[model samples]
Target: MEESIPTCTAFAGHKKIAAGPVVEVAGKVKRYQDKNPDAQILIFDDSSSQQVELDLRGTVADVLSRIPGNQDPDQEKSGPGRPRLGVVSREIGLLPRHWDWLALQPGGASVTLRKLVEEARKQNRSKDAMRQSQNAAYKFMSAMAGDLPHFEEATRAFFAKNRSLFETLTAGWPKDIRDHALKVGELAFHDDKSANP
Candidate 1:
């Protein structure tokens, strides 16, 4: 198993029930279901902070054991050269001038294109992550706090990167909800200048 196996955090209304591996979180939701029959239990991916629905019923272990991105069972074993990189070959249509420009680059068209893509991805990563985080927060908030006071203001503050404003707006919310909202917001708005702890 991968050490960094992603976690999914489970929430019900204003309360957070679990945060851990998918299986464990699913189990927690199952337990929580009994006592809070009317509650809406939601699971959010920790990295994306986006809501994910789990099929937690019968044979869950069997289902989870087949999580995607695991090695393909029927595929032939690897003969190594740079460890595969999960590369896949595909055809792309490009204008003549585009190909001409790429052909002049240092490594060959494929390598040049790959490097360009990686550079663009690196440049946009923080922005992309922030957008995903905001979207995730918005989805959760819409479901859980649509009726709460300052909802719109809080959302505006969230995307505006005004933490104090966001905090003030959510101050009257239930503690669980407020804290979770803040948590999701933080996940979305990581500062590029800050070092990872």
Candidate 2:
């Protein structure tokens, strides 16, 4: 027969029962208050083989800094000044890198992580499209002169080749760029028609 494995659980929010930011949720026979304001059930693995430690003081940050970069589930960069989504990334054992705002939406509405990525990508594409439209009206061509057609051509050829990068770079373009872009577009269109005619 296997000896009983020791376990410890941490509770947050309600201190009347527990001691620190994190109090033992499971341990010696002590009455602990559930932290969730809504009384939502917080579940953890009840494995008998694993030894559990109740770290009340350890924020998600503490657990995150321990995992090796390669071991981190996130492919993105983990650094300070990270956004709110960084919490999600860390919770999922990932370090913030590429995406600033990380949200966990259902995968293709599926349970699989790949489905989650697909959803993230789809959402990113739409966001980028919206960002691109938020451009200023002048000097747009100056900024986009070397990049827009290439982006258009590339995206038309391979959407994966470009994702949120263009929008990121262009989202805050100066108002002058927008006006310049329009003028350039008109000239280019005229030139194209004349050449073809």
For model 2, the superposed segments whose C-alpha errors exceed 4 Å read: 1-112, 123-125, 133-180, 183-197
lDDT: worst 10-residue window of model 1 = 188-197
Where in model 1 is the C-alpha error above 4 Å? 1-4, 34-39, 59-63, 69-85, 88-96, 103-110, 187-197
Compose the digit string of candidate 1's lDDT tens values, residues 68-147.
Answer: 44436556455543335656666789999999999998989989988989899777776776766677678778877889
- Residue 149, model 1: Cα distance from true site in angstroms: 1.4
Model 2, residue 194: what's the lDDT?
38
Best by lDDT: 1
Q: Give model 1 RMSD, 1 decimal.
A: 4.7
Q: Candidate 1: deviation at residue 111, Å?
A: 3.3
Q: What is the lDDT of residue 97 in candidate 2?
A: 41
The TM-score of predicted model 2 comes to 0.17
Each candidate structure's count of clashing pairs: 0, 19
